[model samples]
Target: MIRWGTSAWLGSLAVGAILAATVTFAGVEDRADAGRALPAPTLSTPPTSSPRPTTTTTTAPPDPCGAVAAGMSSRARLAQLVMVGVDPRGADDAVDQVRAEQIGGIFIGGDAVGLLSGGALGSVHATASLPLTVAVDDEGGRVQRVDQLDGELPSAREMVARYSPDEVRALAHKRGAALRARGVTMDLAPVVDTSDQPGRTVIGDRSFSPDPRVATAYALAFSDGLRAAGVAPVLKHFPGHGNTTGDSHLGSVRSPALDALRGTDLVPYRSLPEFGDVTVMVGHIDVPGLTDGRPASVSPAAYALLRGEFAFAGPVMTDDLGAMRAVTDLYDLPDAVLHALAAGADVALWSSGGRTGEVLTRLENAVASGELPQARVDEALRRVLHAKQVC
Candidate 1:
């Protein structure tokens, strides 16, 4: 690990971020039997010839996952890791990108339910080539996306503080079921961040508990519940996003020290099982030894830490690419895609923007330039397909 204050650290951080964000799934499997674990579904490996394209429909629609599995070429597959935004007011270009770019997925803002339900989600599902994983931050409290119409629930801290783990489990199960009914497949939830900082209201009540053990228990329960409801639960802000004074959505954030991260912060995430079939969401926070002061979404050491040390084999996604200030201020759409893939990320996400198609084009160019490895692209596609089958 490079010292936080050293100049040598900058080079490693840049390279790591680029690679980690480029590499990075679909799924609906039943886990309704309470604690019983279900084996995840397998994604299709690359084929010599692409499969025949499926037709779209209103009643049956296309098997969104199947279309994505077949339509993406090797280079396009590499580009799919990027999840860019679309105009919340409504736009046709996003649908066009879904079809032309064969995008990996999309991120919808908290207020996008009307748009998503009206036509946006349906358009992406029916037209996109790959199994597009539609996601939102519906973690309840202030992060609830669907609550504008569905009504917000209690904060995680409040829920855990007032109720039992089983109560949180029930709430998560209900939330997941609701999302699934509306055609949303992934919920970026169960925060799992352990905030120990004083008056740090940003992550406050949203996190399950300040104690890693309690937070871990609640997170596992929430994940199990969501999975049972056929909605994938994403454990977020990996290695932990709780101790930061800065909010990544607004600007860059760094931990006070490595010790602050190792103790209470990462306890819940590190304590979880292999989390083999889970989807882990990376945050934009900058940590010294882990992210080397770059965002975790595009950090090599961050990737190595999550995949190599934590042994979390599930799909990895970034917090919305459209929302993070670090990414928005530094590069254009395609450059973000390249940097993310190179950093070992499986998904580059955005939740608000009109340039989603342009972003996709940039990713395509990078693949053509051989800046990213084709093998990594293939692995990401495989994982996506597998997730859809098993999760």
Candidate 2:
């Protein structure tokens, strides 16, 4: 639903231009420092998800990058941190961009996935050297992207009402198998938000339950199913989006104070680490206690809470940066991307395409001018590359 020529669009372009000019002028003195060699990346392979019961576990292989990341150019390494959306019908263009940009991942909307067959997905995969993180929002029910290809599945609410957590796990396994067959590596699903309000429009039926304990059980079950099927599950809208009444796709939303969130909203995230290496998607909600007023995705304090308070060490990604009005309305696209990285996001998900190259250029400029540290970019790239290898 994001369109060009809106007021927000104009504002973004204006801000981006100003930042570009400023960075270019400041970059002259720091360019040499930016080009200095990075230290060898040390990454531990996270445990892969198991298809068995929650109690079963398996160790993943060694780091996939090895020496490949060290040999990559700054631009190539930066490319690994951006995940962009592409049109399924325009497979040729998407493939061309994959080669041209060396981007880390490609994602398709629910409606677009219906139009793309398995062969089409494979063709896209064939274009990449590294395995592209082919992701889809196949959460089932009202949010599934490939229901046409995978068959219609019940919503989380319906499944929770009619089935046990074990049953939901089995259903997720089936869904994950279908996605893997079509070349999908990641499933952006199994929303763990615990919202009890019947009038919660943004996440009403999407959440498993208002009870945090119940939601956690179903989420872990779903995660087990995905891992069993060889697909990585991305636990989404982190710091919880259930309490908010506003939709981030349209505008900004606010959440409770950190203390209040800890008791209710953060329960699922705190307990999820027992499942192992699950990617957390930071939402665009403003939690006054944690961030003062900035949206969680772009707030350094918010991510600090995730790392320090919650002790989560897995990959952290931003919710759709280009599509969400909470971001698009507040800052230029490039600024949003920089802020997300500065705030400790490992990946910046841009569900709307056509701006990949521009964002990459801006990132290069930021690093050159020392507005963003090169080490920060390297850290984000390391986590992203590691996730692509193991997850």
* Stretches of model 2 off by over 4 angstroms after superposition: 1-66
lDDT of 2 by residue, 56-101 (tens): 2334444435345666787887888888888866477678879888
Worst 10 residues of 2 by lDDT: 15-24
Tell me how far the alpha carbon of residue 92 in candidate 2 is from the true structure, in angstroms, after superposition: 1.7
The TM-score that candidate 2 achieves is 0.81
Q: Which stretches of candidate 1 lie over 4 Å from their true place?
A: 1-71, 87-94, 110-112, 116-120, 197-200, 274-276
Which 10 consecutive positions of candidate 1 have the poorest summed lDDT? Answer: 1-10
Q: lDDT of each model, Cα atoms only?
A: 0.67, 0.77
Residues 1-391, model 1: lDDT tens digits: 1010112212222211111222112233434655875455456654223434444333433444445446556557665666666544453655766776666666666464555555456666766544566676788777787786566778787778778878877888888777776657777888888875543476877888888888888888888777777777788887678888677767888865666777877776675573335788888778876677788777878877888867777678777666578677776656766687777777777676556557656666766778776666666665665565411
In order of appearance, the predictions have TM-scores of: 0.76, 0.81
221 Cα displacement, candidate 1 (Å): 1.5
